[model samples]
Target chain A: DAGVTQSPTHLIKTRGQQVTLRCSPKSGHDTVSWYQQALGQGPQFIFQYYEEEERQRGNFPDRFSGHQFPNYSSELNVNALLLGDSALYLCASSWDRGDEQYFGPGTRLTVT
Target chain B: QKEVEQDPGPLSVPEGAIVSLNCTYSNSAFQYFMWYRQYSRKGPELLMYTYSSGNKEDGRFTAQVDKSSKYISLFIRDSQPSDSATYLCAMRERSGSARQLTFGSGTQLTVLP
Candidate 1:
């Protein structure tokens, strides 16, 4: 089966601009979650999407949002990007809540 | 203090050596512990997982959790060059709904041939 997949392996954005990253969960998966991994750091949870609605969120601000579609694909949007927003955005999917998550290759976002 | 703390080691070891990686957490509510291996420029891949405490082994990987001490460990036997990567420790609390995982800074390992 195909594993999780993400689009635009890399991206570049300037301050005050917005960017969207896409993800397709592994086949037979239903929930999608997003994470941000800064340089020399582990990934921090952003938010999670289930049933086309946000199920849970982490410590992130309102500027970080996400959507889950009927097909179980997901998109993460970050608005008013700051230089600190530059990091590897990772997408993870699981069959259900409280299950092991599988991660995608991630999209590297660079805020210039 | 951070929920979880791990040593970010650029630890170097010779091939065929046994490698031990570990992490400590301050949250007692975290019941599920996991270890993920991530290569440079790639997302993390789940390597081992354990519920509550005790040990689970998969091939060369053995994951151990000590709930009493709030500590978790990953042991790799006969390590190879391919085993070199950043090992991340993640945990989440048991809940009926989805919960966000808290991760550690990850330890980088280099198995030299």
Candidate 2:
């Protein structure tokens, strides 16, 4: 009955650097989505992965990418990080695009 | 204009008081509405969700949606200190395969003992 879990509670990166954050979806869930929450703001959708392929994406630039594994785990990668990339990266999982989503503790990315 | 709009209220109230939080959206296609409670440095936890338009209640929490007005509300009765957190409103269209949600800026509530 474990819920969604994310790795590396926090991370620090610099400009032109790349980082990868990991997520393990809740048990019995198959779809994984990523979001970015800046300080004092609500989370913005980054992208969603279903069937090991990216199914939907938000207004984010190409620097952001994600992958979903056969086991329903996910990873979010950001390349050429900028100072603005500093934010909380959250991972959410649902079942077959279910109405409800469960989120993980999130990885705090600090771009220095 | 943003798809969803909410007041980022650092609303402070005495314990046992009733608290009300609201959000308005510009998108009529959004059919699924949700309220999430987020503690500092933590991911949001879903509080309530409503499909279409109606009222749903769970314990001290009540959620109301007015589709015609494109507004949604969350009411807390007999609030406690544990209820103090940032409340976020999120919604999504029903027709999408991905069903990505659009979220509000979140309202921060503090229930003083």
Cα shift from native, residue B55, model 1 (Å): 1.2
> Could you report the DockQ of all the candidates, in the order they appear?
0.88, 0.91
* Error at A59, model 2, angstroms: 0.5
lDDT of 1 at A100: 91
* lDDT of candidate 2 at residue B82, scale 0 to 100: 96
Interface RMSD of each: 0.7, 0.5
Question: Residue by residue across B10-86, what tens digits does model 2's lDDT show?
Answer: 89999999999999999999999999999999999999989967899999999999999999999999999999999
Which residue pairs of candidate 2 clash?
none
Docking class of 2: high
Best by TM-score: 2
Clashes of each: 0, 0
lDDT of 1 at B101: 85
Kept native contacts, fraction for each prediction: 0.83, 0.83
10 residues in a row with least lDDT, candidate 1 chain B: B92-101
